[model samples]
Target: MTLCLSLLFLFTIQPSHSITTTTAYAADNSLQRVKARGKIVMATSPDYPPYEFQVSKNGKSEVVGMDVDIMKQVAKDLGVKLVVKSMSFSNVLVAVETGKADVAMSGINPTPERRQSVDFSEIYYNGGQSFLINKTDAGKYTSKASLAHKIIGAQTGTLQYNLAKSKIPGAQVKGMDKNTDLVLALKTHKIDALGIETPSAEAYVKNDPDLKMIKSGYSLNKNDTGSAMALKKGSGTLVAAINKSITKIKAKGLPNQYLAQAGKYMKVNTHNTSMFHYWTYFAKGIEYTLLISAISVIFGVLLGTILALMRFSKSKIFHAISIAYVEFVRGTPLMVQVMFVYFGIGIVVNLPALLSGIIAVSLNSGAYVEEIIRGGINSVDKGQTEASASLGLAKTDTMRFVVLPQALKNIWPALGNEFVSLVKESSIVSIIGVTDLIYQLNIVRADTYRGVMPVFVAMIIYFVMTFILTRVLNYFEGRMKHAK
Candidate 1:
């Protein structure tokens, strides 16, 4: 079974390989495989500035930082093309472990548990831990004992996450997928403080005056892994290639030079902040959010209508299938379905993120809409169907001409409510990388480091979207009511 699965993975996951330019002395053979595929894939979470972050250049966006520069040289030396994939930071190590990426280089530090799953390149940038808090709560984290009961936020699978759990005995340590989330949680006081890297803390403080580091409370850990590149386990040749590239880059002091270059791309000006700089982000978010919601609703209603009819059928098999589908979908959470389709099934079919999210959302929404539709059909007067039958009309025509139309009229309000609910719930798809409202705001919050304002804007956008959609649907329902 294991060998069969391995063969299947190789055939499916790894693209067609045309070997070229590989040397014979490479023992690990990862470099040879990469050469055969003709590309080295780098997986990163581009929210970490000065390491990896999105920057707009000449009306286009690109990921740039020290890690990117280092990995470009690695690809250059290996004689392969380079490809980059951005995802949540929590998924990077897993992507390498599962062979989703050849290497992950998003300011990740090694931990003992991570060492068991993947190999690490030599340490690159060494930095300490720091705490960020609202300026008004500057000294709230005076000491370790004082922070025992406070809630602290950190990026999941990081040294800061571990430190927060171990150092602060009674503090509630909430782990999120990105640094920007932790910072936003810090800004809005969701978490009493956030544990961030010293350099990242400095970046945030530099960009926004509302954020300040509590110096006395910040300390270095003996077990700190510093920053390093992660690769699939046992990829000895790839690790060596990356370390050699890192060594050369450092020997020429290119890391610091890269850091200086990245600084020039930061658009945030602490002296002059305005809405003109961020309108495009919220605008794009609104566009995609509406698109996802509209597509999901249309597909959902059509699918739901089918399921409802199956439930009404005389065939037991159809009824059983409809019942099972509705029960299974409604029993599970949307987030789980979204991830399973995006990352789990995505591996098998190579599904795109938008399609995966739409599938998940429609499947989830169909279950509830199925129930609404079924109830609506059942609520129609039995006499209506019997009257159509008395007039010699068939069941299909009876439903189409008389009963279903009336049933639909009865369920229009319910369907509109479901559509509204879906528009709001669509935010969950951002987890699987839809690049909708929430995802864009995360980058904006990190770029500006003025977390509350961007989040506030997102909240308003959501409200405006839902409100306008609700009003439009209500008007349609009124017209429908009067049409009869």
Candidate 2:
């Protein structure tokens, strides 16, 4: 009784909105929800330093920087607590568009594509584009005429990417997911230079002696390039409220003060830079990765069974539908499926990010599982079915007692491979804001600002996970064989 009451109270409770807060949720408005909950949920990418990045103190991790400072002030002006949800820069806008978060801020620039999806506030700060290149050849190629056929990198889905494509006419433009990867890419000459925001470019130069920002060439257009908070379309009440906060802060010149304070702690070695020290990140990553893989596979088995049975059905309709599902799922990339599931179906059903990711993965895996199970059933000899029928068994009983058990035993190893594949493919979920092991590695990469090494460690962690899971599956297979 006590536990039930506690659980009920936890879910039902909502804090009283301050009388000073004018935003009311009479119709469950976004602003009213924030005030009534006494917390504003913000989505950001913490890898962008001086704007937002991770900080470690006494072995605990927290996000801190200029963007966070501004949001904190915004929360204060609205008389609410701020709750931040960190994710990929691409997904940050998705979170806002889906109403999963109240606002999105991470040094995000206003672009036409983004403007079509979400509303932006009055620009908080402006920055032109710049490049961080290798120190060995910093001044070797300044003129656009001399820059032909060089490789340049930028973070995907950002203003810098567009700038790289337009500004450098003859260069190979590489768009990476994380800024740290681009940093490493530049230092190693995987790319000749990296286009990035001015602040991050400066931070990279300041943190490492091997990096230098090229400022004399390629003056990037600053139009629609200012950072701003993002909210859902048609969210004028919240926008106006946040704008009021932005106005107050700019009046006090708080943005400059925040930037100066963030710069003071922006040095790389000022905090824990050791991968061994942040074992919690890897451990949690492995835990969630395995859990998502296992849950996804388990659900895949159930869904696959249905799909397989449909393929075996005599009805052309069920068979066509199953075939179409399998081909479409196999044909499309998992990344696209993840986006549609999260943004399209998720918005309609209002699913959380992790659940949406799991469902997407399960649906993708199920299509393949269907083929595996169907082949296994077909591989069973006709004699087995005849023997079961001769024993006076019904069709369903024959399938259950004779066909499925033998089919499972025959394809156990193939099924094991499917499970193993799901574990690796599960990494795709990280892009959609699932904080599995790979995402944590990016967090560590951004925090330490050492790009390649973190990836090397993540590679080892993934190998270990797949290896252990394979062995566990093998063990279960051996036991099942012995029992049979």
Candidate 3:
């Protein structure tokens, strides 16, 4: 509760909007910093084709698209290497503003709302807007107007989303984080149509015969249609350099060349869209998931034990501190905590994404474990502690030898459940570009355009993993009972 209150107090006192406005032009040397670092990190959501998407080349996964091509040129011009970071579309701009990436470029439109938080390079490509629908519904819904009072889908935090909510009369707007998920929703008839940029809708139409596209038909501003790279506010020098690169590329008509290259890669992805074909992607995801779960479990136990002990301490300060931490963590969602640790504490120290994820999960799990351990300690017969005291055992010795061992035995099942939960919840790390199972699943979905299959595969894999862990835990429970 104390921790939660403190965080809430901080936000209440210094709102993010006010902070953004004040810090928007805080003497940025983003270009100089990039040159010194020798590499420019570009954050993107790799699910939007022609703009940014993932492709597997020679059995190795790679992010490729028109945005990538442009960033590559920008990097070359600046005499630096280009490093791409894949995350959700919503996190792309936050990544730049929070220093996770040098720039964000994933079919991003520079709307006024986005401009307030981040700067954008010159408009590189304007693909316009369109809606994707079932080919059978094409005749019924020829334009955006025909779809009024119907369910419309758009990517959350995009121009299409805003337009759908404001322009479409009586329309139900369903916003999702990924275009792939929106396409799935459209295919399943969960949404009547999906509002998307024309190039992406065209890519989907070309790739999937069941899909069709229609012009949005709304009078749009140039800013609403064009894609641009977003950078931290006050990055004047970096933005200027990138704009120069954009000028050269536009002058040379390189967007057409890049789009053609992206088309070929998309064809390759669709050539073998089988789930079995992308086993390596899933394999890597499983590996990272297990690594994160294992590390978090070890640290969670350590942190939980300390916090639980603190709660029992006679010192008011220690007890208050422990209470604050436990209450705060339990009150908040793990997703928010993950982002806070990754992007908030990140301002003080640059923690790697995987490490940040583990820390957040461990911290979150600790609160739960602390409560569980407290219950177990209470469950231990008070007579046992009394006997320990009668035996001349110190309080610490009693906790370590007499009470703790029995408490752990009583709480073994609860601890096992926590460990299993960690395996599933660790998927949240994907938002920070950690290649966990969920992240890889989304990548496969985007690459294959076979969304449901990847989802089913991931579900099965998770069940198998949790099943094995449960059996292992039951085995230990049996052994402990036998010993008793």
Candidate 4:
């Protein structure tokens, strides 16, 4: 099985290599495409404050920050509207690289490694480097030197993460995708300190009384500290236009103004930090979560039934294809599949985040459902099929009416279990910015600056959702047994 799977992976990767070769020969029309579309989509992770973060204004949630303000001005200069795409910080650059967004700007620092994949604009704002430590440990870990031989946390794929690994002697660096998660880790003593940019550290310190910020005191160039906008490689036209706008903004000191505005929004967010205050955020989260799961379930079952039928077919080609697809999907992680569907397949077809998430999840669930269905069908006695044939019934009718009814009854519990798992697994879509329960939970955590309470609320909500679904499934299962 491992050897077969290895061959399958090689076959799958072959097409992507060809796709890259084709992309290399494609013309660089990044600016022309955006202008023709009349809107430039900018991808960002909105959990970072004063750079890019979510805020409630006039009862509507919107992404806003200095990065957003800078992008807005860039859009204006180019005579186009700015569209914001929010996702995990790690996906921001991927969005631009895959044509999901025209650019990415989330207080991103241009490092040597990142420049290889994406083009960056001129340095915008240098927030410097700092470590977020517990207030109680203030006396023990005072500066960069004190953090030596300590466990340090930093966001993965950021300058801070690299610094934590290279600068600190014997430092066990724990890298996470989101800063809020790292903050929670620090509060729980999972790590001694969190390396972060100075402005973000200050924001966290101001909002949370238990946290304190200390300078990293490491030697760094402007590229290591300065924020910049990342575009797809070969976006010279767009990059030049963005740099021109940035130069003007810097000359007029607009970034300071934008930062001031973001501070006010942050103040509004912190004024009412209660979980109940952000019920709408959770409600919206529940809406999207249920939407993704419900659609995926329906499509998954349909796909599963087809695949199961294909497996039962006498044709070798049909059976081999079904086997390959089922094995491939079940072998890989759902997170990687979601990203592949969104960013990988997206190179050919521009799929929205929600649609990509639903497609990936349905494809994943279909493989498992196919197995459950196959087992259930096998459990049905062969005598039943012979009996149906004896009654002069067609093969299709016999299987659909007699075999399927019994199989469904046998697999009902297993199906229910898969559905329950789907609800939890759907949270993975949040990484692609689907705004499901987990995504909203992160937004609330970032907005309110209260991490634990929002997490607790989301946990209860998920439990309630899955519990209700379990009862409904039980009711149907009971009715099926009553018919017996």
Superposed on all Cα atoms, model 2 deviates from the true structure by an RMSD in Å of 7.4
User: What TM-score fits each model?
Assistant: 0.86, 0.88, 0.95, 0.95
Model 1 clash pairs are none
Cα lDDT for residue 445, model 1? 65
Could you tally the backbone clashes for each prediction?
Answer: 0, 0, 1, 0
- Report the lDDT tens digits of candidate 3 across residue range 1-484: 4356446434432314644533644666888999999999999988888788888778888999999998999999999999998888888887887788989999999998888778899999998999999999978999877999999999998999999999999999999988889999999999999999999999999988999999999898997569999988778888888999999999999998999999999999899999988999999999999999999999999999999999999999999999999988998999988888877776657778899999999999999999999999999999999999999999999999988999988999999999999999999999888999999999988887786999999999999999999999999998988885
Q: Indicate the residue-level lDDT of 410 in model 2.
A: 81
Off by over 4 Å in 1: 1-29, 133-150, 188-192, 214-224, 267-272
Best prediction by lDDT: 4
Candidate 1, 1-484: lDDT as tens digits: 3245435644543322342224322436887789899999898887888788876656555777777887887789788887887777876775675566899888888777777667788887776677888888866665556668789898887888888898888889999987877777777789988888777777778787788886425456434457888887668777887788878877888777877776776643333345457677677777878888888998999999999999999999999999999998888889877866666664566676788888889889999999999999999999999899999999999988997788888999999999999988988877755778887887676666666677788888888888998899899889889995
Q: Give lDDT tens digits, candidate 2, residues 145-232.
A: 4556788788998887877777777878899888988888887788988877788788777777888777526554454888899887
**Tens-digit lDDT track for model 4 on 248-282?**
99999999999989999999999998888899999
Error of 2 at 405 (Å): 1.4
- State each model's CA lDDT, in order: 0.78, 0.81, 0.90, 0.91
Ranking by lDDT: 4, 3, 2, 1
For model 4, give the 10-residue run with minimal summed lDDT: 9-18
Decoy 3 TM-score against native: 0.95
